[model samples]
Structure formats: structure tokens, C-alpha cells
Target: MKKWLYVLGISGSLILTGCNGNAEDTNAETENQAEEKTEEVNEQQVKKEILKAQMELTNTFKPYQQKITAYQAAVSAEEPDSETIQSTGKEAKTAASEAASKVEDFTIEADLPEDVNTAFNDSLPSLQAYYEHVESALNENLEEADFTSAEEKFTEFNNQFNEIIEKAGFPAAPDLMEEMS
Candidate 1:
């Protein structure tokens, strides 16, 4: 009888230990799942914030892009006169100057991820540089309207802008020659 009692006690102890171990494993699995869920939520929020900033920047810059397209179209028209070229240049220059000023006032929302903010911040300097180049080219054209030089500058600007947009994953700006066609 004593041997039977001893066997029952040992069996009961083993069962209890097994139950405790299973409970611990379940708790660990739940914790892991909760952590993964939290990470997914954070990633989603970051994407949302980045998308919002991109849309805002695109909307704000659209008018200036349209002005550039208009200038390109005007100049590319058949047998454009010196007066027409100069007028278009002045208009484009004015638009570029205004765009540069607008860029100064632009702000990304604070909720964006740090990496996204850094990317946007880096992108702005290139845009600013391109705008400055545009202003200078237009100013030169206004002073002594040269269709040859104006066309060259326009091509150069478009190429550079396309490269920049591709790198930054931003929307493509209107193409000058494409608009003319």
C-alpha cells in the first residue's frame, strides 16, 4: 500500500509540472504575437505619414510645373519670334522665382518617420538648386533672347529633374518637349 501511495504522489507531481510548463509556453507565444502586431502598426503609421507628405508637396508644386510646361510649349511653337521667346522666358523666370520662394515656406508634417524626413530634407536642396539654375537661364534669355540657348537649358533642366524625381520616388514633373508635342 505504501508503494502504491508513493507512485500516485510522483505521478501527480509530474502532471502538475507539465501543466505549469504549458502555461508558460502559452504566455510566451502570446507576448511574441503582441510584439509583432505592435511593430506592424508602427510600420503602417510611418507609411501613411510619408504618403501624406508626398501628396502635399506634389500639390504645392503642381502650378509651377504647369507654368514651365506652358513656357516650353510657347517657345517650341513654329517660327517663334524673339519677342515671344523673351516673353515666355520672363514668365517662366517669374514662375521659378515664385516657386523657390514657396519652397522656403514648405514644411513636412512632424509625424513622419525620421528616415522619411531625412530623405525629403535631402531632396529639397536638389530642387532648390534646379530652381536657381532655371532662374538664371531664364534671366539670361530675357536679357538677350536666344532660342538655341533657351532650348538647351530647358533640355538640361528636364533631364536633371527626371533623374532627381526618379531617385526620390516623387511624381514625374511635366516634360518640356513632351508638352510641346
Candidate 2:
């Protein structure tokens, strides 16, 4: 009877050990799933932050696009009306100045990755430079040269800005820039 009791005690302990192993496996699987979920959430959060920053930057620059198109039309007229040119040029100047002001006030409210934040922060200065060039150019006679200068400055900004956007893992920048002279 004592031997039988000893045997029963050993069997019960082995069964409990097996059951504990199964529980540990279940816990491991749950932990892995929770980790995956957390990673997915973080990825989505980063994406959202990137998108929000892009929109704000675009808005700051969009005002210039309209005035540029108007100025382009006025300059490229079949019979260039000095009156129209002067008015459009003034409007473009104002728009550029406004963009510069906006650039000064612009802030990225999103918490992005370190590299991405640096890239984004770097982009605004280029945009400000572009706006400053246009503002100064419009102070003189509106020439084809002024438009070309604006284009060059714009290209520089665009290249830098687009690279940052791509690095953030988004689609190509939408046609944010209009047809500039």
C-alpha cells in the first residue's frame, strides 16, 4: 500500500508539470501576438504623423502657386499689358511674402522619427529661401528671368522636399507645384 501511494504521488507531479508546460506555451503565444499588435500600432502612428506634416507644409506653399500662375499668364500674353503685368506682379510679390511669413510660423506638431523630423525641419528653410528670392525679384521689372530664377529656386526646394516625402514611405508628392513660367 505504501509503494502504491508513492507511485500515485509521482504520477500526479508529472501530470502537473506537463500541464504547466502547456500553459507556458499559451502564454508565449499571447505575448507574441501582443507584441505584433504594438508594432502595427506604432507603424500606423508614424504614418499618420508624416501625413499631417506634409499637409501643413503644402498649405503654406499653395498660396504662391496661384499667384505664380497668374503672373505667368500676364507675362506670356500676346500683347503684354503693362497694367496687367504690374498688378499680377504685385499680387505674386504679396503671395511670396505671405509664404515667407507662413514659413516662419510653420511648426510640425507631429512626433516623427529622428531622421524624418530632421529632414522635415531642413525643408522649411529651402522653402523660405525660395519665397525670399521671389519677393526680391518681384520688386524689379517682371522679366522672364525672374520667373526662371523662381523656377530654379523652386526646383531646389522641390527636390529636397520630395526626397523627404519618399523617405517617409508615402506615394510621390502630388502635383503640388503648378505650371510656373
Candidate 3:
């Protein structure tokens, strides 16, 4: 009877030890899963921040583009001299450049996705190129040069600017029509 009792005690001890080991393993796995989930959430937050910054930068560019368009139209109507047109063009370029610099200064608190970052970095150079082209076109006398040609160049630049906005996945500016209604 004593022998049987001793055997039962040892068997029970072994079972309890096995159960404890299993429990510890389960807990460790749960902790690892929780840590991975937290990392995923952090990555998502960073992507959101990057998207927001891109949108703001695109929005700033729109107003500058609009101003350039208006200036171009004014120059077309009056056939301004080279110096006068160039001066106005320089002012517009300066404004655009300043806005671009501000966009560059925008800081993100989180890591940007590689693809999005590459796209954004590419946009800056294209924008700079468009600005240079516009400046060159504007420096010419409207009467001495082809007004249509200048308009075409402006249109091209505007299209490129809009393309950057599109690639950044930015939504169109909110329509005020609904609010007014």
C-alpha cells in the first residue's frame, strides 16, 4: 500500500510539472504576438503621418500654381515688355520657391513607406524643372514671342504639378458647394 501511494505521488508531481511548462509556453507565445501587433500599429501610424504631410505640400502648391496661371493670363492680354513680364515672373517664381522650401521643412514623426518617400523625392526635382521652364518662358516679350507657346508651357507645368498630387494619393480639395447648400 505504501509503495502504491508513493508511486501515485510521483506521478501527480510529474503531471503538474508538465502543465506548468505548457502554461509558460502559452504565455510566451501570447507576449510575442502582442509585441508584433504593436509594431504593426506603429507602422500604420507612420504611414498616416507621411500621407498627411504629402497632402499639405500638394495643397500649398495649388495656390501657387493658380497665381502663376493668373499672371500668365494678364501677360497674354497686355503683351507686356520682356523686362516687365520677367519681373512679374520672377516674383511668382520666388513665391513658389518659398512655398516649396516650406514643404521641404515639413517634418514627419514616423517612418515613411519607401515607395511613397521615393515618389515625393522625385516630385521636388520635377517641380523645380517646371518652375525654371516657366520662368524662361515668362522672360520673353509677349509681342515678340508666341503667346500660345507660353500658354502651352504653363499648361504642361500645371499638369505635372497635378500629377504629383495624384501620385501622392491626395484627395481633391473639398467642394464648398455642399456647405453652401
lDDT tens per residue, model 1, 1-181:
9999999999999999999999999999999999999988887676566656656766777777667656766777776677766677777788778877877777886486666576666656555555566677676666443445435655664565455345445455546345422
Inter-residue clash pairs, candidate 3: none
Which regions in candidate 2 have their CA more than 4 angstroms from the true location? 1-12, 77-80, 111-115, 178-181
Count of clashes in candidate 2: 0
Predictions: Cα RMSD each: 5.5, 3.3, 7.6
**Deviating ranges (above 4 Å) for candidate 3:** 69-123, 140-181
- The local distance difference test score of each candidate is 0.66, 0.78, 0.56
For residues 17-46, write the lDDT of model 3, one tens digit per residue: 999999999999999999999987866665
Instruction: Tell how far residue 27 is off in model 3, in angstroms.
Output: 0.8
The collision pairs in model 2 are none
Q: Distance (Å) between predicted and true CA of 23, model 3?
A: 1.0
Q: What is the C-alpha lDDT profile of model 2 across 45-98, one tens digit per residue?
A: 888888787776666566676886788788889998888888888888898888
TM-score of candidate 2 versus the correct structure, residues matched by position: 0.76
lDDT value, candidate 1, whole model: 0.66
Ten-residue stretch with the least lDDT total in model 3: 172-181
Q: Please give the lDDT score at residue 88 for candidate 1.
A: 70
The best-first sequence of candidates by TM-score reads 2, 1, 3
Tell me the lDDT of model 1 at 141. Answer: 63
Q: What is the lDDT of residue 60 in candidate 3?
A: 53
